[model samples]
Target chain A: MSVLVFSSLLFAASVAAGLLGAMTGLGGGVVIVPVLALLFKVDIRYAIGASLVSVIATSSGAAIAYVREGLSNIRVGMFLEVATTLGAVLGAYLAAKISGHWIAIIFGVVLLYSAISSFRSNVDHLVPIQPGTLASKLELTGRYTTADGTHAYSAERVPFGFGLMFGAGTLSGLLGIGSGAVKVLAMDQVMRLPFKVSTTTSNFMIGVTAAASAGIYLSRGYIDPTIALSVMLGVLCGSLLGTRVLVKARVSMLKQVFALVVVVLGIEMIYSGITGRI
Target chain B: MRRPSDHELELSVAGMLRFGVTAAAVVSIFGGLLYLRQPHASITRFQKFNAGGPGLRTISGIWHGMVHLDPRSMIQFGLVLLIATPVARVVFCVIGFARQKDRLYVLVSSIVLLVLLYSLGHGFQ
Candidate 1:
């Protein structure tokens, strides 16, 4: 296809990906990679680079709200970033060494996992775990305003949470995704943060984590300006629009539908990877 | 002077991020338009893996291209800005942590910053 037609189509696909991502809280990177590689026939590397850019766009666009809501723990976010950024560098380095097929296979598995997890309702438990010694020393405890009142929570299992964050960052760098599911798992389940805190903090950290590898991608020639331009702009616009509609809409059903879409895409990616079609 | 509360610090970071993302988006759109205006824009240049042009591989190259109105470089410059936004946030946090008289978090933030700068400076080349 000509550049105009191709860009237009890619932009539209990215918009849809962003819209679904915003409504489902999955972020746009997951869908964009599969769409670019499977439908547009773009090379996996370029697709990854482009998808990572859009992830940053959507994350930063949503940051203002998350920060204003007073849920995201900046101290917690900053501390864990050490692990994530380090892992991001490692993942970017490994990307060059690994084959595209293996990357696709791994991405498919992660996609399936995230989609399945999204189906489970997050029941926020108030039974606070005791903060670790490191967490206490570092002051990694805080309270957030709930509808009823302010609720306090503390960080637990700091080392384990940091390790999980490193794995999340590695997956993010490897697949060009936000890896929000893994991040939430680390913060909410492992670290014992509140649900709102976990999700918003995960959102808060994604941009920095993704940015760690983006520069590497840029220098290494994975980034295609034309592709990234369309993808980032389209996703940014779509997610920005999606957030406005979100307040009025019920999203539980929407989440399930998007999860199903993710499943299909995950299967498609794995099939193509196994068949060497990508 | 009193330390900045978490709420105030978050507000500042939020404002900074909003501005950065907006500026990046505007620059990217401008670059995209210029790119589409070129005669050669009809041809797609991304089918295979190539190391990209000199104009986009380095920060100085991007600056030189922007001076010459090169579309790809302009778009890449915008992307570089986007990448830097998060790094900037980390910097902001470091300062915030310091202002709180929290030496441990300042150290933590600095380590994260160093890793980020290292990645951006060069891949494991």
Candidate 2:
């Protein structure tokens, strides 16, 4: 294909990925990597670099909105970032040393896990746990305004949450995906933050985690400007547009469809990695 | 003076993030289009993926490229701005916490900032 045509196609694919990703709350990086690496025959490194850019774009975009809405907890977000950022640096360093095939295989597994987890609803609010001494001292407790009214919640299991965030950051750096799912798992399940707080806080942290490695990727020459330019712009546009549809659109069906797509892509990635095709 | 609450701090961070992402997006779009208009190697530059271009590997490199209107370097410059946005947020948080008299959080945010800068400065090598 001609350069223009190829670039256009990639741009369009990224837009679709971003759209689905936004509506599903998965973020766009997961789709961009598999499509670029498996379908377009781009090398995994370039694909990852490009995908990470999109992750940062989508996360920052949505995070701005969440922050404005008062859904995200700033204190919790900042405290957890210390762990995630450190983990991101470590993961990025490991990515530079690991073989491409292994990265692909690991990405496939992560993708499949996210796909299965995507089917579960994030709308359910959990019982707020009592804040630990560390959490109380750090002032991680906060209230978020919902349609029902302002609800107060406290953070628990600070040490466990911090440890999990480290793992989330590592996965994000290694795979170039947002690792939002893992971040949510840490905050929602382990930390016992409310659903809204957990999701929004996860959104807030993703950009920083991705940024930690984005510089590393740039220095490694994995972030091809041409590819990252198209991917980031397309994903940004798509995610913005998707946000408009999110309020009115029925997303359960769409989530099912997108989850299936992720499963297929995951299997393909794993198969290709094993066969040395990617 | 009453220190600003976390709520107010979040609003400031939100505004900063919005502005940063929007600015980065515009610059990226301009650079991407310029890149498309020029005669380039290929849609996918796998070979060049691992080869660092001097124009995008450092801060000075980006400045020099922007001065010369190099599309790739311009795009890299925008990306640097995007990545730096969150780092900037972390910086903002450190100051916010310090001003709020939250000594512990100020220390936490500063540690995060140091880690981020260290990786940006040396991780690739």
Candidate 3:
């Protein structure tokens, strides 16, 4: 296909991926990477490079609205960041030395895990406990009103949450997904935050985590501006539209459909990696 | 009932505008560049850069130069803009929050500001 035609298709695909990603909370990078690497036959490195930028865009675009809505737990996000940023730096260093194929395999596995987790779970509507700690004592924990009602949440197991963030950050740097699946898990499971608060807060933190690795990728020549720009633009536009639609859409069904898509994509990624076709 | 001070409202609005502009600018600039370039260029660049052989060194050199190209150095100038713009917004928000003594806003904006600085510093190398 001609370059013009190909780019147009990519643009459309990225927009669709972005919308689906934001609505489902799976993240745009997870979708973009497979589409670029496998379907479009782009190099995994460039695809990753592009995916990182989209991750940043997704976070930045989503964060502003989430924060304004008073849904994001800023204190929780900040406390966990110390661990995630550290891990991100380490992961970026490792990524520079690793082969693209291995990165693809890891990304594939993570996606599969995210798909399974999403499919198997239901959103927990638990009330939040008050935060305790020098950080929490500062009144970092708070309540947010979801569509259901006002749900209060809290941060617990501070140390464990931070540790998990470190691992999530590493994966984000390594594979460019912002590790939202893991971040949400850390907050919801380890910290015992309500799902709405955890998800929004996780979104708030993703931009910074992505920026950390994006910088490393940029310096190492992994990020190509042309590709990064395309992905970012598409994601930004799609996310805006998605956010609007999310308010009106039936979320459970959307999540189910998206989870199924992720599972299929994940299987394809793994197959490609093992076959050396990625 | 006490009304919100004009200065406070102005500050809040300014903070919101800063964020909106930054997000829009980044997306527009990057997206426009992508739209302008040929997909064939993207494909060719990807292949050439990834191809392993004696030409690998040459390809790396070219890719490195492209990344560091003048007027558009991805890491040097692009990164500076990316990091600086958001940080400036956070700082402005911090100042506004402090003026109002809104502890929550101050806390949140401060955390975001610090994270942005840390990400910029730790990211490039």
Candidate 2: stretches off by over 4 Å:
A122-132, A147-149, B123-125
lDDT of 1 by residue, B1-106 (tens): 7999988988898889889998988897898899888766433456567786666877888888899999888998898888888988889989998899889888
Clashing pairs in 1: none
> All models, DockQ values?
0.75, 0.65, 0.20
TM-score of each prediction: 0.96, 0.95, 0.78
lDDT of 3 by residue, A24-78 (tens): 7677778889888877777787787778777766666565577566666555665
TM-score preference between candidates 2 and 3, better one: 2
Worst 10 residues of 3 chain B by lDDT: B51-60
Interface RMSD for each predicted structure: 1.5, 2.0, 6.1
Residue pairs in clash, model 3: A128-A152, A128-A153
- Please give the ranking of all candidate structures by TM-score, highest first, separated by commas: 1, 2, 3
B87 in model 1: Cα distance from truth in Å? 0.7
What TM-score does chain B of candidate 3 reach? 0.45
Q: Candidate 3 — what's its lDDT?
A: 0.67
Clash count for each candidate, listed in order shown:
0, 0, 2
